[model samples]
Target: MAEYKPGEMDISVQEKTFDGFISMVTKGAILCILVLIFMALVNA
Candidate 1:
């Protein structure tokens, strides 16, 4: 196993807030696509 020195202990972890942000963006894009399709169907 590799070890990091005390000052060089660069750390990385999946932040909980990041999950919420990604979910919000994904949901927004899906919602926008659905709305556009609905409009096209109605206009046609």
Candidate 2:
């Protein structure tokens, strides 16, 4: 078995996936807020 080395693993893909997740969450939150505002204005 090979010994493990700290900080030697490649994580570019993980970083990209996490960034995309954060971006999607941010956009979804903004859309939800906008929808809520519209609904409130329309008394729904």
Candidate 3:
């Protein structure tokens, strides 16, 4: 296997971390919206 440079590896790691964080935030936001809608429906 080929070896990666420190700077390149750092950037790759950061990109992956950012992507994962964004994904989790998106999922959490969707879940919150769904829950709010459900609660409103139940109340109405």
Q: Model 3 off-target regions past 4 Å? A: 1-10
Ranking of all candidate structures by their TM-score, best first:
2, 3, 1
Q: Which ten residues in a row have the lowest lDDT in candidate 2?
A: 35-44
Candidate 3 local Cα displacement, residue 38, angstroms: 0.2
Q: List model 2 lDDT by residue over 1-44, tens digit each.
A: 99999999999999999999999999999999999999999995
Expressed as tens digits, the lDDT of each residue in 1-44 for candidate 1 is 98757866533445557787899999999999999999999999
Best by TM-score: 2
Question: Which whole-number lDDT from 0 to 100 does residue 28 have in model 2?
Answer: 100
- For 1-44, candidate 3 gives per-residue lDDT tens digits of 89967765447878899999999999999999999999999999
Q: Give the C-alpha miss distance for residue 9 in model 1, angstroms.
A: 8.6
Per-residue error at 14 for model 1, in Å? Answer: 6.7
Best-matching candidate per lDDT: 2
RMSD after Cα superposition, model 2: 1.3
Candidate scoring better on lDDT of 2 and 3: 2
Q: Count clashing residue pairs per candidate.
A: 0, 0, 0
- Model 2 residue 4 distance off true place after TM-score fit, in angstroms: 1.0
Q: Which residue pairs of candidate 2 clash?
A: none
Candidate 1 wrongly placed segments (more than 4 Å) = 1-14
Angstrom error at residue 26, model 2:
0.7
